[model samples]
Target: MKSNNSLTPSYFQFTVFADYGPLRYLFFSLCLLIYMIIISANVVIILTVCLENSLHQPMYIFICCLSLNSLYGSAGFFPRFLMDLLSDTHFISRPFCFIQMCIIQLYLGHELTLLTVMAYDRLVAICQPLHYHSKMTFRTMLLLLMFVVFYPVCILIYFFYLASSLPLCGNKLHRIFCTCWTVIELSCVDTTVIRIASQFCIVISIFVPLSFVLYTYLRILLVCRRSSSDFRGKALQTCLPHIVTFGNFCISLCCEFSMSQYDADEVNSSAIITLSLEFLIIPPIINPLVYGLNLPQIRKVIFRFLRINQT
Candidate 1:
């Protein structure tokens, strides 16, 4: 048998749907279109929030953060994915694979943190209206924004550090992109420490925020039930979009995790590819649309801009 060091590869091959043949072009075209839309829509949201003074409030600031996160996350995945679609041989350099994994993980972590902050923002706005302004002050918002962006990056730096120390036994990645778990599985050494750390990170990064979102929404629902219809309508108008976005994102993430954990040999390759890409593809597209269409201020700003550009 070859030595483990010798067996380790310098590059990883993506074997997901590599045999699609002619259909690869079709998939490439579709993905490129969606990616363009994601970029365009998210840019609109960021620019709209920046240009419109009326949207300088805490809620809209949160929306802007969400849009930025969408762009950040999509940037990590779509470009490489599109490139892979057009390539006959889908391989990534070992260093680039680790870079990609870190970026993708950062995106996921930032997204959940931002959403959790948004949920808290909504909770304050609806449940403690008078305190909303005081609680979500400019200083507070700035701090939260910093935390959202940096917290994930800090965690992922350590994650990559741990991953980098391990000696690999193999280098063939089964999925379209590199993930920490997949890379960990390729290690020749024991991964007990890495596994324990990953579980802890997941709980702190994903589950805690998810729980907060659920709790905040539940409280909002209870409060809405007792309030006047006008108040209820106002609450619904603001909170409904957040709820929808949250639900869609959570479901997509669940699908991603489930597919990642599933028995790859038993599952269809196409299905695995679809599930793997869902969280990356769906949320970025859905989020900007949901916010832009549902929020009247944003909708008006978008229309006004469109009309100006048309003239």
Candidate 2:
């Protein structure tokens, strides 16, 4: 017989899956319905933003990008997740796990950077209305989009470099899906360096954007206070949805980070699963609804599209 130490795991088993028995089907059906809604809702916003000439403005374009990112994040997790809900075996291959991690990390990073840029856009629009058009020009938006999408990619490369060579001591993951940190926890050797590196990544990837977002809103708030009531109401009308979306995403992110880093080893698996999935489920569904329904321009265009489809 081969030595256990010499054998590396080719697949990781998910240990967090609860035995729901007959209720699994009900859970699967509900999740499938949510996935469908996420797709359809985000797609409608994307199509409306692209097709309507009036929506080519920076605000609408950023909203479209949020929907696009939501679609990307949802596609990464929901299909595999839906399958797992109905599956008897919850195992994922090593390579596919890495791919899923990349998709999720990219989605998270892209989201924050995109939100940061949107905050900047609103800052200029509300605080410096005369300079908004000139400041957020076509080239500027293109460069910002490039930064938002690519920054996460660069971080993923470094993360994989640090993690790829670590010898695995086990193959059972205590979560529903793959994550870099979870996999790193399975390493046979001490991972102090890797953990620190990850913290650094979090500060750069999460904290910086979060700080910038807060700063922008502070400036916006100050401007609102100094202006008339009419101006304050108009400013709130423009910034409210973005603020809600940003805050919602931050809370979800906090749940994911807190559960992953602090509670992963010892927490009740059943309890963490709900909050873990909340980050993946809530934001994608909520983002488009908040933006599409609350914003009159996108909502008007979406209604027009629906009317055309019906007729």
lDDT of 1 by residue, 1-311 (tens): 66755455778888775667899899999999999999999999999999999999888988988988888878888889999988888889888888889888888888878888889898999999998888999999999899888988887777677667677787777888988877776788787777777767765766878889999989999999999999999999998888888888788777776665654566688887888778888889889999999989899999999999999
Global Cα RMSD, each model: 2.0, 1.9
lDDT of 2: 0.86
TM-scores of the models, in the order given: 0.93, 0.95
Q: After superposition, how far is residue 22 of candidate 1 from its true place, in Å?
A: 2.1
Evaluate all candidate structures by whole-model CA lDDT and list the values in order: 0.85, 0.86
* Candidate 1 ranges beyond 4 A from true positions: 1-8
Worst 10 residues of 1 by lDDT: 257-266
- Residue 139, candidate 1: Cα error in Å is 0.2
lDDT of 2 by residue, 1-311 (tens): 53565346778888888778999999999999999999999999999999999999888888899999999988889888888988889999888888888888788888878988999999999999998889999999999899888888887777775555677888888888888888888888888887887888776778888899999999999999999999998888889988988999899888788786774668888767888788888888888999888888888888888899899
Cα misplacement distance, residue 148 of candidate 2 (Å): 0.2
